[model samples]
Structures are given as C-alpha cells and as structure tokens.
Target: MSRIMVIGSLNMDIVSRVENYPLPGETIKGIKTDVNPGGKGANQAVAIARAGGNVSMVGAIGTDVFGDQLLEALQQENIETNNIIRKEGTSGLAVITVDSKGSNSIILLEGANGLLSMDDLTDILPEAIKDPANIFLLQNEVPWETTKNIIESLSASNASIYLNPAPAQHIPTEIISKLTGIFLNEIEATIITGLSVIDQESASAAAEKLIAYGVTEVIITLGEKGSLYRDFREHVYFTPGRKVNAMDTTAAGDTFIGAYLASKQQGYSIEASLEYATAAAALTVSREGAQKSIPYQEEILQFLT
Candidate 1:
C-alpha cells in the first residue's frame, strides 16, 4: 500500500443547517447544528485510511478540549498522528453553514493551525518522508513559507508532492512551479491566475497559466459541473458531475482528493481514478459533516456501479 503524508490543518467544524443562506446582514433560522472533527488535512487523511491506504498526518493542535477530541477521532480512523504539535492555544475552527441545496459557506479561524512554523514541521516526519513509497499531500492551511521550506527540502526520497491550493492566497510563483501535482477549484484557479473561470474555456486558460508556473499535472474541480484534468502528456480529460440528492456539501472536495490518491496508489488508470473519486464526492455531498460523511471504498464502488 502507498503511504500518504498529509501536512496541513486540523479543526473542529461547527456546522449549522439552514433553509437558505442569509443575505447580507439578514437573519435566517437554522434547522439544526452539529460539531464535527474536520479540517482539509484531517478529512483527506481519514478518507485515505478509510479507503484502505496507509496514512500519516503532520499538523498543529491547541491544548483545548476540541483538540483532544479531534486527535482521538483521527486515531480512531487509524491515522498516525505522532507528528502533530500541540501548542498553547485553541485549535482551528470552521464555522460552516449549509443550505437546503447542499451548498455551503465557511468562515475559518486559523487558531493553532496558523502557529505551525518551518522549524516545527521540518524534522517531525523526516523518517517518514525518506521512504520512497510515501506521497506528500500539502494544503494552504498553514503558513506558505513553512510549506515552501518543506517542499524545497524534500529531496531525501522519491516521494511525489501533491499540492491542494485551497483557500487560495498569494504564493511565490517559483515554489508553485515545483509541485508534481496541483488541485484547485474554479474560483481558486481564477484568483491565482487573475482570470475569469466561469466556463471550461476559462478553466483551460487558467490551467495553462498554472502549468506555465511549473506544476506537472492539474485537476480543476467544478462543483455540480464535474472536473477537468491536464497533464504533461498533452492529454485533457473531463468528467461530468454525477447527479445526486445532495444534503450537505462539507468536505466533498477533500473526499475527492483522498479517493483519487487512493485509487492512484492502487495502480488504477487516471480515468478510472477520476471516475472513482467523482463517485466518492457525489456520496459525500449527499450526507452531512466532513469526515463523518466519507463513504467507504465499497460504498463508492457501489455508487459508481
């Protein structure tokens, strides 16, 4: 099995289900509320482990009750967390609001996630990264400089680097170009490239810009519309979104990435991997919460069949 290392944020997600997202300054009554252990990194790690991959995580948590619960949840999922740094503050949190259409709006608080520094992450996983069988999956939840340092110094093994540039922020162009793989949403692509990404034409255009900056492969996720793929081999593929009765859309993209990585590690072809991941994400949207909704591999296979 492929060993995956996810280096990013861990948070407690506070979710509220509302009839519709309130307009600017408008008040709307929510149907229910729930708290779940979530964070893009944690969600992805769980997805991989549940899909039958070996996974380890590197992140920071606070010395709060939320942090304690989140760590336990990860351990229950069989994700290795020996590298998680516990700091003196509260853990990160995402205030998520889901509407009846399964659409979501999130307000994230950095909290302890923002405290991870270059020194804190450097030696924590050196032995793990030395194994050529591992893959490093990174996110933008931590400091950009810290991520850059780790990626730049990751020459100890042949492990490939996969970057998910979510919550897009200004990053150094040189650093982005070194990524072996990149995942981004349509909006994030536009923000990074200063292009309008309302259609495939724009997505393709923006992707070209990103490719010019150095990524070897790119996956642009278009919610409800499907996804587009580009690689150094000059082939482009698209998968139209599968129809489903979506209830809460939290962690859908993280689920997609996790499933995709697991499929690739299983030696499935790119087309098959994308199809499987799309199916997994479709199931994720039909449920609620983040890590709580990720279907097992068999469940996703059944959905696809």
Candidate 2:
C-alpha cells in the first residue's frame, strides 16, 4: 500500500448552522449544531486511508475530552496514530459558522497544536520519514519551525514531500525548495508570490513564481473556477471544478490534497489523480463537517464516472 506521513494539526470542530452569517453585533438563529473530529492533518489522514493508502499522523491534541474524541474518530478511519501526543492545554478547535449558501466563516484557536515541539518530533526520529515508502505531507496549522526541522531531517531521504501551505505564512525560500509537491488556493498562492490572481492568467504567473523559488511542482486551487498545476517539465494543466450545490465548503481543499496524494501513491497518473481529487473535494462540499465529509474511494470512483 502507499505509505504517507502527515505532520500537522488535530482539532475538534464545533459547527453551528445558521440562516445566514450574522452581521457584526447582530444575532441570527441557527438550524442545528454538532461536534466533529477535524484539523487539516486528521482530515487528510482519513482521506488518504479512506482512499486506500496507508497513512500515519504526527500531531498533538490536548488532554481534554475533545482530544479523546478526535483520537477515537481517527482510529475509526484506520489512520495510524501511534505518534499522536496529548498535551496539557485544550485541543485546537475551529468554531465554524455555516450559512445556507454553503459558505462558512471560522475562528481557529491554536491550543494544544502549539505544544507540538521539536522534542516530540525528534522522538519519531528519521526512520519514520527516512524510508523511500514515506511521503511527507505538511501544512501551516502547526509550528512551521518544527516543520522546517522535520523537512531538514528528511531532506536527504528518498521519500517525497508534499506541502499544503494553508493559512499561508511567510516561510523561507529553502522550505519551498524542498517540496516534492505543493497545493495552494489562489489566495494562498498570491500570499506567497504577491501576484494579482484575478483569473487563470494571474494564477499561471503565481505558479511560475513558485517554480522559480524551487518547488518541483505546484497545484493552485481556484475555488469554483478550477485548479492549475505545473510540473518540473513546464507542462501545465488546468482541472476545471465540477459545479454542484455546496452545503459547506469546510475542509474542501484538505480533501482535494489528501485524495490527490492517495491517488498518486496508488499509481494513478497525474490527470487521473487530479480528477479523483476534484471529485473527492466535490463530495466534501456537498456535506458538512471536516472529516465527516470526506468521501470513500468507491464514492469518488462513482463520482468520476
């Protein structure tokens, strides 16, 4: 099976459904509420496992009830959580407000996620990621410094590295250089490149900037407009998103990146993998919650056809 290692956040998500987003200082009525296991890392790990890849997670949760539930949920998805640590603080949480339009606004509290220290990472050692079978998946939810150290430790390994620079932050050019793959939205890409991405043209320009910075490949997600991808060979492709009524856009990009990695590890071609990834993301937006919305491989295959 395709083996994957993810270093990111694990969070408990509390969701509230409303008629529409409340105005500043204005209260609105909600239809329902629920709690779910989330965090971009956990979502991606579940996605990979559900898509038939072997996945492991290295992140921290708090020593709280929510953290306990998050771990249980991940175990149900068959993700390897042997390295997941529990800290003293509250687990990270995302307070999500979803409107009837399928749009969402989130308030993220980086709680125990901040406690994932270099020591915790060093404990996992080089073997976890040093082998050729490992593909490292990273995001910005946790401390980028710790991520930098991990990337540096694995720099000489034959394993591949995939980074999703979400909630984009200012990182060194060297980190960008180490990536085997990168997934970003137009806005995240713009944050890195300072490009005015009003459309595909600007998106291309932004991707070019990333390539110039040493990323081997780049994939820029453009919401409903679709996605743009470029490889080392200068071959560029655009995958148009399939339009459907969206229920909640939470975790859509995470699902896309996760499924894409899983498909690639399963030996699917670039085009086919993107198609599968797109379909997986499409299914996520049709539902609610983070991990709750990720589709199974069978569901994605059906959607593809």
Candidate 3:
C-alpha cells in the first residue's frame, strides 16, 4: 500500500454558528459554538486513517493541554505520529464562523505550526522520500518557504507529492512544476493563479495555467456545485456534488482530499475516487464538527452503495 505522510498544521478549531456572516463593524449573535481538534495537516491525517489510507503525521504542537488532546486524538485515529514534535508555546488556533447555509469563514493563529522547519522535515523523511510510494501530502498552513524547500528537495527523487494550498499564497512556478498534483477549492484557485473560478470553464482555464507551469494534475473543488479536474495532457473531468442536508461545511474540503487520496492509494480509478470523495464530503457536511463529522471508510462505502 502507498503511504501518505501529511506535513501540515494542527489546530484547536473554535467554531461559531451564526445566521449569517457579520459585516464589517457588525456584530451578530451565534446560534451555537464549539471547539474541535483540527489543523489541515492533522485533519487530513485523521481523514486518511479513517478512509483506510496508510498515513503518518509530521508537524509540531505546543506543550499545552490542547497539544496533549491533539496527540490523543491522532492516536485514536490509529495514525502514525512519531514525527509530531512538541514546541514550548501555544498550539495553533483557527477561529471559524459557520452560517446556516453551512458556509464558513476562518481566521488562523500560526503558533506551533509556524515552528515546522526544513530541519524537522529532514529528520522525518531522510532517504524514504526517494521511494515513489512514499507520498507527501502538504498544505499552506505551514511556512511557505519550508514547504517550497521540501518540494525542491524532492525534485531529485521519485517520491509522489501533492499540495492542497489552503489560505493560498504566491509560489514559484519552478516549485509548482515539481508537484505530482495540486488540489484546491475555487477560492484558493483564484488566489494562486490570479484567475477567476466562478464556474467549470473558469476553473478549467485556471487549471490550464497551472498545467502550463508543468504540474501534472490539478483538481479544483467547487463547493456544492461539484469539482473540475484538468491535467497537463488537457484531459478534463467533472464530478457533481451529492445533494444533502448540509449542517456544517467546515471539514468538507479536507474530507474530500483525504478520501480521494485514500481511494487512489487503495487503487481506485480517478472517476471512482472523485465519487468516493464527493460522497465522503457530502456526508461530512450533513453532520457537525471538523474531524468528528468525517465518516470512516465503511461509512463512505455504505453511503455510496
């Protein structure tokens, strides 16, 4: 089986559910609020494990209670966490607000996640990344420079790598060329490519730009509408999102990514994997919380069947 290693952030997600988003200088009462163990990296690790992918977590956490809780949560998922180090200060934090429509906005505090460095990566991967089956699942929650260095370091290796650039930032085209694939939502798509992704055609145009930069594959997720896929070969595909009662969309993107990668690792075809991921994400939105809302592999299978 292919092993996926997630090098991303771990945060305590604080979420508030409001009727709608508050405008600038406006305040609104929340329907409810809760805290959950989440970080793009940690969330994806839980997702991969739950989706039946062989996964390991590599990152840093604080020495606080949240860190202890985060560690315990990963352990419960049966993910390998040997590379998750402990820093001196507070853990990462994500303050989020979800509307009744299941849409959300978030603000993040870097904290220990910012402590991740190339040295940490060197200690974790070493020579294993030379193996193509050792897939690295990364995100933008960590330092961009560190992330870039990891990609550059693997340029000489055959390792498979993918980036989910949430909270998108500028990256060099040379670095983009080294990736096996890039998965992102429409909003993130706009930030990275400087193009609008209001629909499938727009998303494709954006994907084409990345393909021209030499990334092998690009998948742009369209919330509720569906997802669009395009590769360097100009081959394109679309997968419609499943209609359901969406309660919270906090983990939808992460769940989709986790399930899709797990499905691919398990030898599912691209079409099947997209379906699996869409189903997994649809199931996640029907529930509440981040990692807690994500379904297990059997649940996705059952949901599909």
Question: Which scores higher on lDDT, 1 or 3?
Answer: 3
Question: Where in model 3 is the C-alpha error above 4 Å?
Answer: 16-33, 97-105
Model 3, position 204, has a per-residue lDDT of: 89
1-305: candidate 1 lDDT, tens digit per residue:
66889999999999898998888999878899999999989999999887767888999999999999999999998999999999898999999888887677889998889999978865765777666778899998988877888788663354589988877876567877778888889878888888888777777777788788877888989998998888877678888889999876778999999999988988889999999999999999999678999999889888887
Among these predictions, the greatest lDDT belongs to 3
Q: Write the per-residue lDDT of candidate 3 for residues 1-305, one digit (tens) a residue.
A: 66898999999998888998989999889999998899989988898899999998999999989999999999999998888999999999999888887677889999999998998877567755755788888999989988888888776675788999887777678888999999989888998899988888899899999999989999999999999988877789999889999887877999999999999999999889999999999999999788999999999999999
Output the number of the TM-score-best candidate: 2
Q: How much lDDT does candidate 3 score?
A: 0.89
Q: How should the candidates be ordered by lDDT, best one leading?
A: 3, 1, 2
lDDT per residue (tens digit) for residues 1-305 in model 2: 54799889998888898988878999778899888888888888998988778899889999899989988998888888899998998999999887887677889998999888889976585767546777899888898888888777777674588888878876678888888888998778878888877578898888888898888899999887888899888989889998878876778999999899899889999998888899999999998677888899999999888
Which regions of candidate 2 are displaced past 4 Å?
A: 19-30, 99-104
Clashing pairs in 3: none
**Can you give the TM-score per candidate against the true fold?**
0.91, 0.93, 0.92
